[model samples]
Target: MSAKTNEPFTEEQWLKFVQQKQLKFVECQDCHKMSVIPFAVCTTCGSRNITWKQASGQGSIYTYTITAVPPPELQAIAPYVAGVVELQEGLRINGIITGVENVNSYPADLVGKTVSIEFLELDRKSILAFRLNA
Candidate 1:
């Protein structure tokens, strides 16, 4: 008997996409506008000539807030920092800021501070995060 093989290509592709730290953005060949999320066709000019490009992985802290009350599963890790970081390439994503011991000590003037990408493990999955670029 032959063994049956099944694998979700899209999911696997997405996993690899995230694991490799490859930031893909859709660039319209016609309008020359880049979008963070990939699309089959460009939303700006309705062009299908969009291509994916890698980002520099550098950004700034747009905004952030601290969460003290986490869900039951995350209760042990309460008092975490979450924020939306605006990438230098013009993409904004929400992620946790690691490497900080005290939330109160977090600098409020982080809006223009440089940051870089970092990954963390949660529930057996890798999550994209950011860290101060000291």
Candidate 2:
């Protein structure tokens, strides 16, 4: 079943959508700009007219960095790739890059590589991630 919400979405809501496989982003009705980050007012044009739109789960890696040493809480997934992805809608969002053969030594040609949204189980909770497209 599809999910729906009236209130402005937060990180928690976004995570829920990821778990449900129904990722969504906010689009400003005034400026027509979109953002994966939830906000009560549009950041682009200061408009309150915003609507939620379904994400296509397709994007290209804008940039990335390999986290060789993560925080104490994220030690389980150390040496992970994290980066911003430019979605099909032209908006960028931050997500973990999964399906890497070797986190410690990732390929140099990762920028602009195609990726698809995915849900990963970490610490017994589902989190949003992006898988490299074949």
Candidate 3:
């Protein structure tokens, strides 16, 4: 997998959002439904006319997994957690889980737990990540 927004997330446009320090999501122009994952059409209205909106970046860990075998690009930061965060806007997006050096430091379980945004800066590029919320 790549840090650059995956398929359907449209790299150029998605990166623009990330660079702007905004968590962007698609909102159906017709139905006004939000979708964090990029798609060919709105899941609700099946409309192609959708616009990007800035999300509040507050969410909960829908689910998570710690990667013991880090990818080559992130070997230095091995054993990281990655998961889908369900934002306050009612959409879920994938992001790396941060602010933990290991798996056993949680005060509570991650699933359904609250989280906040923490942009990870790597090699002059900014990427979306998360940390446990207070």
Candidate that would win on TM-score: 2
**Cα lDDT of model 2 by residue, 39-66, tens digit:** 6677788987777789998999999989
lDDT of 1 by residue, 15-66 (tens): 5666765554556677888766556566677776655556677888898777
Clashes of each: 0, 0, 0
Number of the predicted model whose lDDT against the real structure is largest: 2
In model 2, which runs have C-alpha deviations exceeding 4 angstroms?
1-5, 9-12, 19-21, 44-47
Model 1 TM-score is 0.76
> How do all models score by TM-score?
0.76, 0.79, 0.77
Q: Model 3: which residue pairs collide? A: none
The whole-model lDDT of each prediction reads 0.67, 0.80, 0.76
Candidate 1, position 123, lDDT: 68
Stretches > 4 Å off in candidate 3: 1-11, 37-49, 104-108
